[model samples]
Target chain A: MKLTINRNYLNDAIQQVSKAVSSRPAMPILGGIKIDVTHQVIVLTASDTDISIQSFIPIEQDQMIVATIHEPGNIILPAKVFVEMIKKLPADQVSIEVEDHFRTTIRSGSTEIQMVGFDPEEFPLLPAIDQNEIIQIPGDLLKTMIRQTIFSASTSEQTPVLTGVLWNLKDNVLKFVSTDRHRLASRTAAITAPDQYQFNHIVIAAKTLSELSRLIPDQNTMIDIVVAENQVLFKVDNILFYTRILDGTYPDTSKIIPQTYETEMVIDTKSLLEAIDRAYLMSREEKTNIVRFMTIDEHTVEISSSSTELGKVTEQQKVQSYKGEPLKIAFNSKYMIDVLKVVDSEQIFIGFSGTMRPIIIKPLDHDYNTYIILPYRTVN
Target chain B: MKLTINRNYLNDAIQQVSKAVSSRPAMPILGGIKIDVTHQVIVLTASDTDISIQSFIPIEQDQMIVATIHEPGNIILPAKVFVEMIKKLPADQVSIEVEDHFRTTIRSGSTEIQMVGFDPEEFPLLPAIDQNEIIQIPGDLLKTMIRQTIFSASTSEQTPVLTGVLWNLKDNVLKFVSTDRHRLASRTAAITAPDQYQFNHIVIAAKTLSELSRLIPDQNTMIDIVVAENQVLFKVDNILFYTRILDGTYPDTSKIIPQTYETEMVIDTKSLLEAIDRAYLMSREEKTNIVRFMTIDEHTVEISSSSTELGKVTEQQKVQSYKGEPLKIAFNSKYMIDVLKVVDSEQIFIGFSGTMRPIIIKPLDHDYNTYIILPYRTVN
Candidate 1:
């Protein structure tokens, strides 16, 4: 393969694909990034058995020639070194030529790097998924959904299903739910999809979702997602991301969310976040990370945390509105903080059904997001 | 202690002194920051046995009241927690009150924190240094000198003195030298000091110098440096930094630098640095980090590195001037990159005695800086 391509474009593509390259691949060939040079486009692929990422660079883009191909071929190069070398290449235009025995020479400006490549046939083929039904979602909405719920996924592998976020699609509404037994986060978005193109129990690993989130554009571009029996594919612009669906069934969490509240309050998100943050500092020293929330009055609430060795922190803020009987609850401040950070609303609604029940938090102005945290049973 | 202080000022002072606070102190008290409050000023100090830093916040600065004292007292608070708490405090003005038994209450806005403070009397006292003669230097210059030589200091404790940078003050000139016996870096600056007040054999740990460097202001402000028999005190504005001198004799490195050269070349510092940086990436894979430099002709030079598994990287650049015989030498590219990063000049002069002799590098327009790197004995 011989071609001169725009260095910036090539570097950008390599970076996108490098995210799927594992530091410790199960096989030596799996560590290589497969490069396929065709007359129309150059495709770069990297995989670590769990997920595969492919990025394509076309011959010409926006009237400007991106690559001038003299020969068409394919080769697999070591991902780590190739990624670094491509980023640091000296010139705007870089020429890559693969000779006999897969010896590749990369030249840019006055610098030339010769690297040994592996045969493309040795690399594992990406799993093929039949795209009979495709679901379309805004890129920014997908990114937001992943960021909002991925953190709630259990990092422990004891229950493999809990490590993945469950994607539920029905009636043109896409819902993402993740829970770690102690807490749960759910986000829903309205998308344009055929009524028959609905799927449930489509769980994807939180790690793979996070990587896909990074690849998604920040703008309101549309992303095409295709789900098969055990494999899922996401096409973001010219990049194709594929990951295997996690095995096992996700536990049903609808029963945990309370339908009624004994007390509810509307509070400023930033103010409550800051108060809980300060209380968190003290609770962190105790390792329990328990912070107490108590209603001081109809318009005021107090947040406090204490450590035997470091002392106590207490703060009170005025809430917009409060109803029903006064209440007190204790919860892990870290979980609250995580939920608050992803909240994009100015005000939040918090509901409590006495002290022992799960505390529900939702955006005050919308019904599309919900978070539930189990309160810690503290001896008062 | 009872006082209402500006949170920003107190936070800055705490951050400055916290640099000396060790994560794992030999004694638990060493992990705390000592705070002394008087009618005139509030003093914050932190020590890790080897280094002690004290910062003073006066009652008023620039005609603005920094603190209002209601009572005078002292206490020691855990540095890590205190630092983090101060940063997240809720208000601009914070009130700190020490009740009976050293129980401190910090109030800001609607938030209140009660911390269990340790008795200041239990904290270790800083070593007293007698200052008969004082030397003055620009803070920026001292920072630059430390940055230029500290990277070359030996990190191993086998030779304790090599872990410290030797400071020789003579003839109103302060010279700093550091080496790991493989490479050496020296920087000198003219200072305002008494002609009779010359001192030598003063060695300070690289770690201490690094901390002191951070405390120094970037502006060209005058700094008072006092050398004691066993300690050195640097008074930068309202902050006093004291460090114990390392106990050992430094080896003489003057003999290692070549006096005359068999070949000399003047080159653009940035171009040579970039070429060597790229070559270093390939050499790093081989673990030896050896990059070969050879004279291509009167005005051109080649830099290259190779790995048995990764192949080779080669780059050629043009030099401004070249004299004497053409030669080839191999040296540690990492060390060369380190020196190039600290160089402030655009053009550099390189002098090589032969393929095996030590290579000398100096700024083309100044004589205050010098670096010597020994070439590797590679089998061609």
Candidate 2:
């Protein structure tokens, strides 16, 4: 393989695929990034069995030549070294050539580096997915959905399926839900896809979704998602991200969401978050992270936490509106802080069934996002 | 103690003393910050046996009231919790009051925190330093000198004195030197002090100097340093920093620096640094960080590194001036990078006696700083 490419363009493409490079590869070849040079484009691929990422650089972009291909061939280079070297190359343009026996020479400005490359044939191939049924969603919307729900997914491998976010599609409306049996987050969005196409019980690992989120451009572009029997492919711009579908059935979480509340209140999101944050400093030292919330009056609420060794922290803030009986409840301040951070509304609506039941939190202006937290039982 | 102090001023004072708080305190009380509130100022102190720091917040500074003291007393609060809480307090002025039984209440805006405090008498007191003789130096100059030489200090405890930087005062000139056997860095500067106050063999731990560096103000101000029998006291503005001197004799490193050179070259500091940084990516993977430098003709030099598992990297750059015989030498790229990072010169002069002798690096424009690196004997 022989080609000259813009250093910045090559570096950007390498960074995109580097997320899939495993730190501890199951096979030595899995630690390599496969480089393929064709007549029209150069493709970089990295995979770790569970997740695979491929990025392409075309010969020309925006009337500027990004890469010049002298010959078409393929070689695999160690990802860890290649990524760092490309980033610090001393010139705007770099030339790479694969000589006999897979010895590759990379030259830029007055610097030249020779790297030993492995035969590309030894690298694992990406699973091919049938794209007959493609679901298209806005990149920013999908990124938001992932950010809002992915954090609630369980990180432990004991229940492998809970480590992924469940995706359900019905009537062109896609919904995402994730829970660790302690707290749950769900987001719903409308997507453009074939009316006849629908998927259920499809779960993608939180780790995979996070990588996809980073690859998604900030601009409002369309992303095509294709799901195979056991694989999912996300076509984002010139990048293709593929991941294996998590096996096992995800537990039904629909029944756990509270439908009604005995006590409801509207509070400023930032104010409540700040109050809980101060209380968290004390609770965190105790390792329980339990912060108590009590309604002081129709328009005021108090947040407090205490450590047996480090005294207590109490703060009161005014609520926007309250329309129920006064109540007291305690919860893990860390979880509440997480939910509040992602809430994009100025005011949030909080509903409580009782002290022991699950508490529901939602943006006052929107019904698409819902977060439920189980309150801690405290003997007061 | 009862006082209302500006949150920012209190926060800045706390941050200065927080550096001395040990993560793993030998005694439980050592993890607390002693707070002494007097009529004129509020003193915050933290000590961990080896080092102690005290910062004072006066009642008024720069025509602005920093603190209003209603009652004078003393108390000690947990450093970890108090530092974090003070940083995020919700008001500009926070009121702190000791109620009874060492229960302290800190009130800011609508938030109130009660913290359990330890007896101030139990906290370790700072060592007294004699001030009959004092050395005064510009804060910025001291900061720069520490930055240039501190990186060469040995971190291993086997030779405790090597972990400290040697300070020699003679004829109103103060010199700092540090070495870890393979590499040495020294910087010299003139200070205002009594001619009769010359002192030698005074070594301060690199760790303590690093913390002192952070507390130094960026503005040029005279800092008074008093050397005690085993403790050194630095009065930096309103902050007092005390550090224990490392025991043991420091080895003489003066002979290792080349007095004469067989080959001398002047090159742009930034250009050479960039080339070696790229080579580091390759050498670092081998864990040896070996990079070779050879004079090419009279005006050009080549920098390269090779690994048995990986291939080689070669780069050549032009030198401003070259004199004496041509030579080739190999050294650790990581150490060279550290020396180059602190060089505040556009061009650097490199002197090499031979392939095996130690190489000397200095700013081409000044004689205040010097760095010596031992070359590696490679089989090639």
Candidate 3:
């Protein structure tokens, strides 16, 4: 097989697919990227068993000859090294030739790289899918939802389901929720899908979801997500991302969310974020990383943290308003800071019932960005 | 002890001296920075046994009251955390009050930090030298000299002297030489020194030398480097960096560098560096990372590398001239690439005597940088 392609075009396609390539694959052949040169187009595929990314480069890109194929063939080349070599090649056009013994030669200008390749037949085939059962959402919206909730997913594999984000759809709306047991983040958005697009529970690994987000460029492009029995496929313009679905059921986290509040205060988001950040830096030397908060007046709130080894820090910030009784409470400063970063609001309202009760943080204008953090006990 | 200093001024001084503070210090007291508040100035000092850095902030910074002396006193605050706290403080001027029990109160704006301070009397005092053997050079030039030769020093402590750079001074020139036995780098620059300031051999640890460079700002100001019998003091503006000198004599690397070459080749420094970089990336899978070069003709050079596991890469470049005779040589691409990166020249002339001999890469003109690398044997 022989083909010539524009170096920049091939580099872009290879980079998109290489995101799914695993440096240490369970199967040796899985470490390579499968390249298929057909009469119409050149396709690149890379997979790490859990997630597969595929991109197709058309014969013509912007009135330029991106690829000219002499024969229809396929070969699997080492994904990581070949991609790096092609990126460093000096010429504008690159030619690739595959011999009968699975030897691949990539040449551009005066630089030529001859690498050992594996037979494309040995690489795993893309799983078959019924494209009818799919949910459609804008790429940027999906990426935003993933970014907000994915960080809360448990990184450890001890509880497999918690390592994935629970995606549930109901009444033409898609909801994404993630939690590591200490805190939870959920985002919901409307989608133009049938009300009966029957899906009860689907947990996709947080890492796979994040990789899918990275593959999609930030645009108003739409992606079709299809969840089969045990695998999921995302179809974009000339690209496809497939990931395996988690097997276990996710826990019910609805009850832990606060339904009522005894006291509420509205504070500037940036000021509170900065105050908590300073408190967090000081609390790092303490055992619990605890920071205390109290309503000093109707328009002022105080934040403080103490460490026997490092020191103690206390600061005050002015807020828009405060209600109910004045009180002092302690919570993990890092957790509060994390929630504030993702909850993008100019002024945020925080509700507290007591010292050990969960604190609810939400935008005062009733937007969908709401977060709750369980407070640590302060024995005062 | 009481002091109110401008936060920016204190932060800058702390950042410079904190480089010498090591958390896992050989001496426990070295973990904290010594703070001495006198009538007129506030002094901050940090030491890690091998190196000591001290900086003073006077009372005249923006008419800010730096120190009131309240009874001149001293204490040591944990270096790493204290610096971080001061950086995050809110107020422009910070007031620090130390009680008799060593409880330190640092107040800035509404933020208050109470930290435990250790007795500053336990801190190690740097060796004081009375003999004034000093050489003066531009701080920027001294920083550049340190950056150029310090990377070649031996990292292993097996032969302690090899881990230090040998400084030789005579005839108004200060020469710095460092070698790990495999390769050597030496730089010579003119300096202003008194006639009595003569040193045949003085070794300073490469780690200490590099840290001292960071303390020198981008001002074209001159710094006095006083080299004593057992200590080296770098006095730049208000900053003083003192380092314990390595005692043993360094090896004589002058005889190993070849003065003449049988074959010489002149090539564009940027092109040669880029080609070597490409060859290095391909040779990552090989055992020795060896890249071979052959003088093909009067104006052509061929570069190639092959690994049984990853296959082969070959590149060729056209040059201005190849003198003497046709030659073939192989060397560790990583080492040569590093040396090429630091050599600043548009055109570089490489000189070689034999395949097994060390190659010297110098600028087409002696006014530019020079580098030398040892060749590795290629397997037949």
Candidate 4:
């Protein structure tokens, strides 16, 4: 196998696939990236069992030749070393040639590096999946949807299905919901498709979506998402991202979200976020991370937290509007902080049902984002 | 104690002293910074066992009132927490009041934090040191000298004296030397002081100097360095930096440095550095990090390294000049890389004594810097 490719093009492509490669893969061959070069394009692929990334660089792009392949073949090179080598190469063009012993030679400028590689046959091939049902969504919006919900997923392995963000696509709107059983975050966006094509309970791992988001360029270009029985594929430009679909029935979370609220208050997002942030520093030492919020008057709210060892912090700020009985509730400050991060509006409406009930936060001007946080019982 | 100071001014002062504070200090009170307030100044002091830093923020400077003190007293606040709190304060000016029971109230805007702090009396007092034998050096140059030689010091605690950089001053020349018994780095600079204030073998811990280098502002102002029996102090602006001198005499490393050499080659420092850097990656996998250099011809030098598992990297670079017998030698690439980083000339002179003897590297046109690296023995 012999090929000469543009340094920047190869570097970027290798980096994209390398994220799917694991350093401590179960099989040694799984730690390598498969490189396949044909008459038209050079394909770089990496798989770490849960997810696989394949990126292709065409021989000629935009009337300019990016790669010239003298011979078409394939080789499996160690992902970590190959990426570093290509990045540090001296010239703008790099040539790679593989010999019978699976020995690879990489040359650029006056520097030549020869390294041992694994056989491509030992590596896993891309899994075959039925891609009849396809949905197109804007890349920028998809990335935002992933970011807004992924962080709410459970990191623990005890509940396997809770580690993924649930996707429900129906009526041309794609809704994402992620809950770690402690807190839940949901976001919805309207797409160009119609209700004729609908898919539900398609769970994708939070980590998988995080990697896919990074691969997609930040633009308004359309990205094709193909669904299968147990595998889902996201296509961004010439790159294909395949991930395993989680197996389980998602719990019905709507039963827990209160249909009616006992109190509602509108406050500046920035002011409340900052106030809770300061209070969090002290509560962090108490091990509970509980910060208390009390409504003092029609236009007043108090954010405070105290620890027997770390002392106390109290911050009072006037809200834009408040319509609720004067009360104080304690909850995890981190949940509030995370929910406030994705608030698209300057003012956010916060509704509380009871001291022990889950509090809801919604964007004041739009119905696109909503967050629910469970409060902790505190003895006043 | 009561004072209202500019937030930024107090924040910057606390950060500088916080460097000397340790997270795992032997004494609990040592984890706090002593705050001393007077009619004219507010001093922040922090000290770990190895180093102590004191910074004074004057109430008035440059015809501007920076702080207004209503009362004068002292208190100790936890270094880490206080610094974070001051940084997050909402108001431009922050008022700090220390009352009975060591309860400190820090108020800024509508936010107030009350925390229990240790009594200032529990903190250790600064050690008394002789201030008569003082040597003056420019702050910027002192920082440069430390950066050039500190990395050469041994990081292992087995060799206590080798972990300290040796300072020898005579005839208005300040020379710093550090070695780990395998390699030695020395730098010399002439200062604006007379020979009457000469001192020799004043050893300071490399870690202490590293922290001190960060405290000194990047300016050309003169800094007074005071030498005592077992301590050294540096005064930069209004900050007083003190470090305990290491015990035991530094080894005589000058004997290992060769006065003359068998072969001398002058090469571009950057080219040789980069070549070795690439080769080092392969040699690093072999466990020795040994990169070999051979004089191929009158003006050519070959740099190469190989591992049976990771393959090899070879680079051929042209030199400015070469003399004497053509030879091949091996040395630790990491040491070469570190020494090359501090070379002051574009063209550096590399001299070899033998295959196993120590090599010397210095600036081609000047004798301001010298580095000696012991070569590795290779079976050819």
Q: For model 1, how does the per-residue alpha-carbon lDDT over A150-262 read when each residue is reduced to its tens digit?
A: 99999999999999999999989999999999999999999988676789999999999999999988777899999989999999999999999999989989798888899
Which residue segments of model 1 deviate by more than 4 Å?
A: none
Per-residue lDDT for A50-144 in model 2, tens only?
99999999989999999999999999998867899899888999999999999999999999999999999999979978889999999999999
Each prediction's number of clashing residue pairs:
0, 0, 0, 0
Order of all candidates by lDDT, from best down to worst?
A: 2, 1, 4, 3
lDDT of 4 by residue, A263-331 (tens): 889999988888888888888878899999998888888899887876788998778988867778999
**Candidate 3 residue-wise lDDT, A1-380, digit = tens:** 89999998899988899989988988878889999999998999999988899999999868877788987899999875688888888889999999879998988888888898998999898889888777899999898889888888899899999999998888888888888887788888888775588575799999999888888888789999888888899988889999999988799987876777788888988878888888888888775778989888888888999877777888888979888888789888988888888776688888888777778788777556557678887786
Best by TM-score: 1
Candidate 1 has which clashing residue pairs, if any?
none
Which rank order by TM-score, best down to worst? 1, 2, 4, 3
Error of 1 at B189 (Å): 0.8
RMSD (CA, Å), each prediction: 1.3, 1.5, 2.2, 1.6
Prediction 1 global C-alpha lDDT: 0.92
Cα deviation of B219, candidate 1, in Å = 2.3
Work out the TM-score per prediction. Answer: 0.98, 0.98, 0.95, 0.97
Estimate candidate 4's alpha-carbon lDDT, on a 0 to 1 scale: 0.88
